[model samples]
Each structure stands twice: as C-alpha cells, then as structure tokens.
Target: MSNYKFILSGGGTGGHIYPAISIANELKSRFPEAQFLFVGAKDRMEMEKVPEAGYEIKGLWISGIQRRLSLKNFVFPFKLIDSFLKAGKIVKQFKPTMVIGTGGYASAPLVKVASAKGVKCVIQEQNSYPGIANKFLAGKAEKIFVAYDGLERFFPKNKIIKTGNPVRQDILNVSANVEEALEYFQLNKNKKVLLVLGGSLGARAINKLIEKELNFFAENNIQVIWQCGKLYYEEYKKYENKNIKVLAFLNKMNLAYTAADVIISRAGAGTVSELCIVGKPVIFIPSPNVAEDHQTKNAKALSGRNAAVLVKEVSLDSRFEKEFKSIITSETRQKELSKNIKKLALPHATKHIVDEIEKILKTL
Candidate 1:
C-alpha cells in the first residue's frame, strides 16, 4: 500500500467543491491507503459536503473581498492573518506530501502556506478567465491544470497543463441510458424534452425565464425537466404538473442528461465540461453575476465554434423564445450541436491530473 498524504482545498460553491471531491475520489481509487484532508472556508458548503463525501475537512476563517464597500471589508485583513496562522499549523501537523487547490477563498491561505513550507502544490483553474485567488496562487503552484486554452495570459507557459475540468463520473455514460432515463423522470418518449439547469443554489433569472415560458412549452407539446434549485423550490413548486417536473436539485443528473433532447443552462466551467461529455444540444444563458464574467466567456467559446447557442441575460425577455425555438424546431441544428460539442469532451481529466500528481510525487 502506498502511503501518500494529500491536502485538498476548495469550496464556496459547488463548482469548486465538486471538483475537489472528484479529484480526491480519483486519488483514493489509485491509492486506497492514502490519507486525505480537505480545507475550506468556515460555515461554507464544503464543511458539510466534504464530510458527507467521507473525508475529514478543516475550515478556515476566510471570505472573499466584497465588490462594494461593506463592514466585511474591515474584517478581511484580520481573517486573512488568522487563516494564514491556522493554515501554517495545519501544514506542520498534516505533513502532506502534496497540496491541491481547486480555487475558493479558503484555498488562498492553505496553498500559500503549503508552498511556503516547501510542499508541492497543484492548482486547477476551471474557467477561461481565472479567479483572483487562483491567479495569485499560480506562481507558487508546481503545475496549473486549466480547462481552457490561451491561459498563458495568466499563468507561466511552462506550468500550464490543458487537463480540462473534472466532472461527475456518473454523467460520462448518459448516452447509453436514454430509455431508462425517460422512465426514471416519468416522461413520455414520444415528446421532445428540454432540461433546464441553473446549478445547485439556482439562478433566479433562469427560473423567471422558465416561468414565462411554461405555456409556450405546453402549447408546443414539449416536456420540461427543470432543476429550479434549492433556494427557489418553495416559490416554484406550485408549477409542478403533468408536463413540468420541478426539482430543487437533481441527484441523478445522468438520467436528466439522457432525457434531454436539448439543454438550457448557465455556462459554468464544470457545467460546460459535463455538457461536452453528455453531447447534448445546448442553449447557454450565462449568469452575469460571476467573477470576471467567466460564464459568458465559457459560452462564447462553444458558440464561436458552432457547438452551442448563446443568449445574453439582458436580451432574454425579448429573445428567449425565439432563440430556444430555433434549436428545438430544427433537427439538423440539434445533431450539429451535439456532434461538435462531443468533440470537445475530455473524459479522462481526473485521471490525467492524478497522473501529473504521481509524476510530482515520484520526484520526491
């Protein structure tokens, strides 16, 4: 049994947390006896999610700087210093062979301390535009795993590896289960299905868009599987009926992907990676609230290649139905989008990243 010790830090949103978990799982599969520890921001989603994934996690008192002036800004410096001291202690106690950061507020201090202590560090940048935390950590990282090309603009050219973003393994084989997926979601196989995703917490604009288009979906004989997200479920649950299935969150995304003839979603880096692997015709309404407006950049990458369609939030009220109808009504468009998106899938990203970690470990 190999006795490698690892410290993984990332979490604030599911985008960061899931990739950290996926990487940890890939590492555990290869080294069954390996020890893993996850570091994340206190009171954040990762504190709950990491333990649920069957790993121990430590929470750091860290948060991102608010874009606007607020009381939190004054507390930021103290939190940073406290987190750094705590991260240093954790590194000394854990004595990890390597540290991996997937990018979140907590990741900054942990990876910084680990690198300062002369530990190997690897960072995964999930977006075309790197976040502030990852951009700062890039110099100290031994290798930087990126999901997009042209990231040499942010990190050193020699350190960047185009490994792609890690996605849930269950989503990889969705194509083979179409019939099962239709039955699981209790939808008819004869009608076209549109799956709408807004991520785990949910997107308010997407939810409102669906609300506006409900009658249009019914009139056109289309079925909808809408994952409205946890925060909006109570408000939108009344819309659940024969033709519309409203879920707070989808635990079986494989089934949802298989049932979808077309997907309408926010263009998160992880979502983009999964959609490419699922090979579905997609209409991207990128969330405008994200850092550096990365979601728009992600959607544009595919739309520019004719792999997906993009609809900006500002034009949604005037153009959603027209843009959505264009895809759903055309069989040739669906096939073309699916074929092109599938060409972009990097199914072995987790395995390849682990291989890089192994290479670094071998040198030790």
Candidate 2:
C-alpha cells in the first residue's frame, strides 16, 4: 500500500510546476516508499524543476499549438498523435496507481491516455480560468481540485473540490521573525520595505514599471527587495544601490515575505496563494498576455472581497503610484488587507490535497 506509484504531469510555467512539486512532496512525506514519476513536455521548465525537487521525470515530445497560423501549428497534430502513443506507453510501463495533472499542454496527452487505460486520474486547476488541458480532461478525471469558485460551469460540480492553490510549505510559515528577515536581506530597519516579484521567468511589464518607479520609491523612503526574475536580472541589476536589493530569484522566499511591508507582484495563481498566506498588503498587476487573462480574474477574486488591491498592467502608469501610496502610507489599510488576505489562505492545502490522494489510494 505504501509503495503506490504516482504519475504527476504539468509544466511550462512555475504556476504548474511548483504545485505539482508540492503535491509530490506531500505524498512522499505521507508514503515515503511511494514512487513518483513526473511527465512533462521536453525542453519545458518542468524537465529541469522536477529533478531539482529530487523527483525522477520523463519528458514527452510535446508542445502547445500556436494560436496564429504558423509552421508550429501545422505540426501540432502529428506531435499530439506521437505524444498520445508515448503517453500510452508510459502508462503501460509505469503502472501508476494514480495520475495527477496540474495544468499545462504536457498534461493533456498523458492524462487522457491514463484515464482511457482505466487509471484513476485527478487534476488540480491553479487559475481562476481552467486551462485547455484541464478542461479537456474534466470528464475523465476522478476529482478536480480547484482554487477558485464558479468553475462548476466548466467541470462536473460533483467532482470539483475548492481546496485553494497549493503553495510552497515555507511560504505558509512566512510569519516568522521579521527582524531576522530584514537582516538576511541586509535591508534598513528604518525604512518601509517593498518586495517586487514578477513570476519565475519575469514579467516584462512589471520589470519596466519597477525600473521607471525607482525614483518614486526613493522619494518615499522605501527600501526594496526586487526579484526581477532570472531573465530580467541583468537589465535591472544596474538599478541596485544601498536601499535596493536586486535578485534573479529569491531562494529564501519565506524571508522575502517576512521582509516585505508591501508587495507589488504579477498575479500568477501560485504567487497569489503565497501572497495570501504571507498576509502582506499587495498590489496585483496581472499579465494580460495569458490565456483568458486568468491572472486578472485571480486578483479580482481577492480584490472584490477587500482582501487585496487590483491594478491592471494597462492602468499602472496612471494608477499604480496612487494605489501603492495609499496602501503603504496607512497602517490601518495595511492591517486590513493583511488580515483579510490571510483569512483567504488555505495554509494546509498540501495536506488536504494529499488527504484526497490517500483516499483514492485506499480504493486502489
């Protein structure tokens, strides 16, 4: 029973990769003898990240279809058929007790094949709007784990579980010592600290906005810990000075959360979940480039509940400073936002997800 094999598939972005890692980690803790095999699209971030998390992963020759007419789109059908055959082979070889899809194009073929082969499959949707893969697998997946409401429209209402999004375990404990965090970042204790996060790869618009507003932050006596992301670090590193700490990625994110008095971030689902758990006042600038603009919807869910502030990328130049100044300048506003946002946190999300996984395992 403890040696049950599990197959987890999803990737392309950190949004999908991190959640799958979190779930795998939790399952490992519960059943240390369990085998985990991750399946992802070759050359995707998951190919690198899953291994970093100490799990073995196999890559499929898969990629998403281009929206516009292109050579890539032309080859998509052949790729899909090839991937489906490979996924069927993987299912037959792995003989996994369960298959979990987090959300991405890579998960589609694998989950579809696994379910067709009568393997139990479950999926966790990280965004407010479900991705194409998750939507396609809805009918076949045994359970659908989701972070937001109103998804019954897309998935079977009976199978949907609103468990919130799974975030890193360290982030759940981010309320730890603020002074130590400040020291770790080498930040000034006298000034308000602002944490800037663009997703894992970095958001171009958010990075540009941060660069343009450096003078504004200095004028307001704010010190910043900016995680401009790996891709944007070189471009933004020149702006780092005594008051600003620029990082490609914050390996110590719990410390980053503790150090921040106010956070400005792109509203990716995983980031939003972590932010809610961190309980910091935030200004959400969602990426419009994403499918269905789900980031905006994720941010709006909290903003509508008075849990966070929503500032769209398009309106940032005109409204960001005003919104940011309002939150940072007022203790009452910060406290209110922090309190409301924390209330929305499902700190035990990983545990709950594993609990459900265990229930399915028992049936096996």
Candidate 3:
C-alpha cells in the first residue's frame, strides 16, 4: 500500500511545470512509497516533460480564456465543465491524500474540485504577482506557498507562507565545473559567454535584436550560448557560426547557466528562480505579450533591490548593448548582483515545500 497519494496540477508554461515537478520529486525522494499523479492542460509541455521526469500525468481539456473577442472564447464554458468533471474523476480514482497546484491555466479545475471534496489542497505560487488561477484557488487552499514577499495583496494573508520557488536540484548542486560545462557546450574557455533565452518559443523582439547585434558580439570578442527556441529557429538558423551556439531548445540549462557570465533572459518566474541560484548578472527583457506584464514586475522586484538589471522589450534596440556592456564589464556590479540575488536563492526550496506537505498530511 502507498504511504500517501498526491494529485499535482500545473502547466501551460515551464514556470508552472517546473515547480510542480520539483515538489513531486522531493516528495518521492522523501517518501519512496508515495504515489503521484500530475494533471496538466492537454497539449502543453508538461504532458511530455512530466512523464520523462518519471511521474504519471493526466491531461485536461483546459485552455486559457481568450481576453480578445474570438471564437476561442465560445468554448470556454464547455471546456471548464469538461475539465472539472475529468478532474473529479482523477481525484476519486487516485484517492489522493492531498492536492497541490503550482499555478497555470490547468490549476483552477484541479484544485477547485479536490478542495470541494474536502481533501487538503495547497498551491505554490512562484511569482510576486499571483496568476488568476492561483488567486482563484487561494481562499480554498489550506496553504499558499509563495516565492515573493508582499503577495498577501493577491491571496489570503493568513494562509500565505513564503517558501520561495523550487528549482531543479541539479542546478543547486552544480558547481562551476567550467571544464565540463565548456565541453557540454563545446565552447572555448578563453572567451566570455553570454547566454540569451526568450524562453521555449523565442520572443520575436529579442531574436531580431540578436540578429542585429550578431556581428557586434563577434567583434567584441564575446561568444554566445543562445537558445532561440523552436518557433524562431528557422528564421535565425543562418546566423549560426563559430563562437555562437544556437539551439532550438536547451536541454542542458544547468551548463548554460554555469558557462555564461551575463544572462539576457525573459523574466518568467521559472527563469528568475533559476537565475537566482545561478547568480549571474542579468538583463531582463520582459515580454510585453504576457497576461499582466508580470515578467517586468518580476524583473523590477529583483532590480529594485539592486539584484539585477532590466531592459524593456521596446527599449532593447537602443539599450541592449549599453546595459549588457555595463553589467558584464563591471566586476564590482556583477559581484553585488551575485551576492544580493543569492540572498533570494531558495536552495532547499523543494525540501521546505515537501516538509509543508508532510505537515498537512500528518494532521489527518
């Protein structure tokens, strides 16, 4: 018999998927007899990533509600009804002792149905500004785990616990391993490396900015570990050359973090969590395309504390080089960011989050 069973929900983006995975992994590690079942939006990355990580997952027919007037909005009611029914089935079949959400489009249905059944429900929100689904689940959640402070504005203050975000354990455990990292990327140790990520799909503006500055990077004696992402890879593949490694997806992000001195990243919650552990100087280019401009909010939280830098997407054409140059060249500035941001690192975050889970389980 299993010691415990859990139903974990979150997806639609790496930010949500990763934190859920970290918690699941930690739970499994601590309680080897634990059974975990993940629920994510159908067709999202978690459907594949979770299984690969050695967990079972079920897909729900949930998708984000369209903000614009579109045909997609017509199906919202039906999808919600269908997803909630399916979530109820998953929970009943699994007989979960607890349910947890990391926050995404898929989280709402899972947490709502589980909590309605009187199971212990918890949500881990990995941002300063919580997403709609997490905010929706906040009141019902027995505990709300957050990475940023002052999030009581979104959730029930009495219920919130600041546990920080869970990052991959390997990243926290990894040291410079400069030689091994260089070999992983097949990069030269003599050159300074700049790692650029616009996330899994690539941001158009960051891609174009990099194209414009490609020659400049080569000229500046800098090398690049660029993850252009799948959607934009075809358009930018021709620019691939020596000293520039371009990937549609970076499977070895831990090495990418170790190899780079400066990071140009979209300030997604997951990216920010990883960066705090990586503790490199960063230039955040918040995608103006997100639901609430939360990326900028995340970046500002770091920069406001003198922990990082921000360059708005619209301002990138003019300011990318200048800001990047200033941060990379200043040893003093890099040291400060590294030290201050490391203050935000949740190195044992997975452990702490799982500890809370055990606390809830023990109360029963």
Best by lDDT: 1
Q: Write the per-residue lDDT of candidate 3 for residues 299-335, one digit (tens) a residue.
A: 9999999998889977877888888888777889889
Is candidate 2 or 3 superior in TM-score? 2
Q: Each model's C-alpha lDDT?
A: 0.93, 0.91, 0.88
Which stretches of model 1 miss by more than 4 angstroms?
Answer: none
Clashes of each: 0, 0, 0
lDDT of 1 by residue, 1-364 (tens): 3899999999898889999999999999999999999999999999999999999999999999999999999999999999999999999999999999999999999999999999999999999899988999999999999998899999999999999899988877665478898899889988999999988889999999999999999988899999999999999999998779999999989889889999999999999999999999999999999888999999999999999999999999888898788889999989999999999889889998999999998999
- Local lDDT at 78 for model 3: 97
Number of the candidate with higher lDDT, 2 or 3? 2
Ranking by TM-score: 1, 2, 3
TM-score of the candidate numbered 3?
0.94
TM-score of each: 0.97, 0.97, 0.94
lDDT of 2 by residue, 1-364 (tens): 6999999999999899999999999999888999999999999889888999999999888888787788998888898999999999999999999999999988999999999999999999998888999999999998999988899999999999989888877776666598999999988889999999886678899899988999999999999999998999898899888899999988999888889999999898998988988889999999888887899999999999999999998899899999999999999999999999989888787788889888887887
The count of backbone overlaps in candidate 2 is: 0
Question: What is the lDDT ranking, best to worst?
Answer: 1, 2, 3
Candidate 3, clashing residue pairs? none
- After superposing candidate 2 on the true structure, give the runs of residues whose Cα lies further than 4 Å from its correct spot: none
Q: How far is candidate 1 from the true structure (C-alpha RMSD, Å)?
A: 1.2
